[model samples]
Target chain A: MLKDFVKNIGYDDPLEIYLSKLEKLLGSEYGISKRAVSLLLLQEDEEIFELVKKNEGDKIGVISAIIREANSHYSNPLSYIISERRQGEASRITNSVMSVKEKGLFNFKETLSRLMMNPFIGGPILLAVMYYGLYKFVGNFGAGVLVDFIEKRIFDAHINPFMVDLVNRYLPYELLRDLLAGQYGIITLGARYAFAIILPIVATFFFAFAIIEDTGYLPRLAMLIDQLFKKIGLSGRAVIPLVLGLGCSTMATMVTRTLPTKRERIIATLLLSLAIPCSAQMGVILALLQNKPLGLLIWLGVIIGVFLFVGYLASKIMPGELPSFYMEIPPLRLPQLSNILRKTGSRLKWYLFEVLPLFIFASVLIWLGQITGVFGFLVKALEHPVRWIGLPAQSSVAFLFGFFRRDYGAAGLYDLKTAGLLSGNQLVVACVTLTLFLPCVAQLLMNIKERGIGVGIIMSTFILFFSFSVGYFVNLVLILSGINL
Target chain B: MRKIAIVGSPNVGKSVIFNNLTGTYADVSNYPGTTVEVYRGKCKIGGEEFEVIDTPGMYSLLPISEEEKVGRSILLAESPCVILHVVDAKNLARMLMMTLQLLEAGMPVILVLNIFDEAEGLGIDIDLDKLAKELNIPAVKTVGTTGAGMDILRGKIEEHVKRFC
Candidate 1:
């Protein structure tokens, strides 16, 4: 019935001309309306064109001519004209049925939502959120206080010693004892790191994230930062993955599927793997640079610079049109405390379950490497590049640990910083280098899962070289400038 | 078996309606693209069992992203008995264009004006019966999150299937 109404509206003349051209050029009986197919073809919609071109081989020329004739009738592109007509009809129909009631204003929520999207005010608001929610709350309170209570009071003071004694008593073999209770042992190191350090940091970060997300601040943040992002070949929507990358890069890489274009996804994935350090790394970096503002700034500058430079370069190198950005701006509301807590708890529970096994596996791998002397050999190989970046040979262990888990490298760095092995400048360089390092094992696997293995391997190799090279340059520049922190 | 596929852009209460219809868990969150995979369950309306498919959010039939592709594929292949184009009532103007696209594709679409409570609070009131007449398809206003107007929606769905099917 609707088709009859449309047919009676006299599109038949233009459509018939299109069909004849289609039949003449393609010579097939696909019977699909040529005008619609031609319009789709004009918009460079590949799938329909391929279908029509395959079926209507000889008549394709006629279809082209008909499309050309229709094109000539409008100054604007036919696709745009067609879509506008459809949209106009939609609006006309909607207008006829929908009415507006004059009511009291929702002025308060409107004003607050507006304030969040305003660049001038939103910038400072963002910083305040980051400072309190992330730095002070997550870093200082969760990582500092909770980690100290768990790692020192519970594990170091009690569990490690108890586990060592138990292993020595039960497992008489030296190898088994070392595997379970030594410095790199599964029980002593991995379990501790997973529960004591990573758990608290992740829990806090998720708590903060939930609050921010529930308030609908993220889309507003995206809108606020859209212009700055355009310079880096991304739009505001990319900010979702980037910010989530701070929580977990592996998850963020999966989320990059939301990006409209292949180019955008690759760019986002690359930026995520290189510049955006995950929550674990961020916590350790924050702790490492807690008192060193200069070091923090230098580290921040290097990562941001690499993120922009590489993103710009990737956008140029990748063969695709840049995607236009359009996203809905959601209204902001006061976050419910219970919702925030529940979300954070669930997320933290998920994170812990995922990371605990990996952490233990990493520790077992390290133990195996140590027993076989492969760990020493790999560290020796890493020493060359370590020296190139002016970092000590021992930092190779952290870099080695980094391949297994970013948080492990961060834990290594934290240990190093505590031992007074690295100076302020060295700490800055290490944090910058490690933060820009390849994502953890899970992220690597996820990248392979999302993008093919070849792409994943290529991405990892590029990140490894790029991160170290950037570190080398930063160190060189700092040395030349003689601004020793 | 008959099927009703709920389709729309993300975060427009499709999941809420799906849950209300099927009484299943779908992890309804306040974010978009959370429902990445299609979820299907049974809905019994008027002593008739219908399968309800909750698709990944999609902006249009012309897909640009993976999730949208998933949503579009479900529509094209499954050919549901009724396509519930669930859209945010507050953003009706922008969203109705997709409704137009769905109708143009000759799919059996029922326009669901979701989040109508919020839309009403924002001063918008939709005349559902009039909208049904204009679009030549069933139109229902719902606040899915709160289960408002759900009985009417079910009634409309049953009536639509009885007449059209």
Candidate 2:
């Protein structure tokens, strides 16, 4: 009844003829009109190409010829030509139907938004925001005071002792009691790490991220970083996933699918798995380095250096066109408090559900390994790398925990640092190596899912060895220079 | 039952419009590229039930990313009774490329100039009647966040469904 009531694109005669020809050859029906499918094919849409090749076997040569003819007539790519023509028509319609009132009171949001995109201004503003939002809020308060209170006051003084005593009194079996509430018990290590150490860190991070995200500042950050990013073989578009990686790398790995090219996805996945530290690890690292300013600076320097060096090298090795970025920057707004709270709430729920089980599971695996002597061997294997990096052999446990989760390893470091086992040089080296370590197992699996098994395994292996080498090099440099930190 | 699918470029208020129309929360955020999944909800207009699918923001018919591919596939598969070609009102020229594509596909699309208030605040005024007449389809302006112009939109949806479905 409504056959072509609203006219489609006003295609020129040649294109219209080609569409009809392609329509007839399409043979089987796609859910959409063959006209649309033909347009997609002209644009060289890969999935549509596969669909057409499968559905319209012998007729493919003729369709390709038609597309080739169309391409010859246009200097621009067909996709560009098509969109440009559509835009021209849309402008014509919009010009006739819309008017500007010209009341143009300059909005403050507009000025602020422009300021945020200017590199000179935006860089300083970004630093300030990070210092206050992440350093002060998440690191100092969340990981420092909050974690100290929860891990020491709440758990150490009360919960762990209570649980241990309760288990000892109730369970006569020594192994069962140890499994339940021993030194590395599920109750003591796993739940404590989840609730006491990592929780406050990520809670504060998500809160800060929600507010930053809600204010629509990330795109501006992208614009500011575009110049720097290009040098690393990524365009500004890579900023979104990389910034989000600061929140959680597993989620960020999944988010990499939003990148325009498979090459971009691979580069992004590789970079994220290596240099980007998730929120929990970031906060904990920051808190650890807070007292040692020199150590913190060294760690920061090493990470940025590795990020640039490796990215530049990878871009050179990988064969792909340089990424061209076009992004929409939403108008900055005062973040709604209600919305921020809801975002934080939802993210916290997601984080807890994801990590809490792994925390407990890692605990069980460790306990089982200890009973079977596998844990000792694994730690022994890790001790060589730890010692090579100038860290104590006991720090090997932290490296072992790194396989489970980044933050779990950091929490282990927190324990070692509190026990005064690592020096200033050792602390800086440890933070650098761990920050560059392969992301958690979930992220590893996500990498395989997104980038396939070969790339995934290869990337992870590279990350593992590269991280230790960087640590060893840093340690060597510091020792040779006789640096205090 | 009839169906309406909301489609457009990212950061336009498609998800907000979908939420306001269907009263379903689908994570409306200021950032684009956040929604990597599709959302669907059942809505009722004019005493008849309808299914509304909220697609990921697609830039054009041509797919650049997985999200756009998913968005295009949803539109192709659902064959919704009405497609709301939601656009950022301020950038109507860039957004309407997809609208033209939908029209070319012979889909019943209603041009929704969303973020209407912000566009007006920027001194941009759109003539709904003239746009509707020019396009030969319903055109409505909506500030999806504030629920402004929702009633007229609902009316247009019902009219479109009654005529087509």
Least lDDT summed over 10 consecutive residues: which range in candidate 2 chain A? A1-10
Q: What are the per-residue Cα lDDT tens digits for candidate 2 across A1-485?
A: 33655477666676667667777778887767777888888887888888888988898888888878877777878787677778889889889988987775767888999889887899899999999999999999999999999999999999999999999899999988878898788999999999999999999999999889888999899999999988878889889999999999998988787888888889999999999999999998997787888898889889989988988989889978888989989988777787678778878888899998998899889989999999999999989889999999999999899999999999999899989888899999999999998789899999999999999999999999999999999999999999986
The alpha-carbon lDDT assigned to residue B1 of candidate 2 equals 62
Q: Candidate 1, B80: how far from true, in Å?
A: 3.5
* Stretches > 4 Å off in candidate 2: A1-6, A24-27, A44-46, A73-77, B1-4, B18-25, B40-52, B150-155
lDDT comparing candidate 2 with the true structure:
0.87
Q: For residues A253-355, write the lDDT of model 1, one tens digit per residue.
A: 9888888877788889888998899988898788888878788888888888888888888877885765677887666656667556766776777787888
Best candidate (score: lDDT): 2
- How much does each candidate deviate from the true structure in C-alpha RMSD? 4.2, 2.4
Q: Name the lDDT value of residue A177 in candidate 2.
A: 87
- Model 2 TM-score on a 0 to 1 scale: 0.94
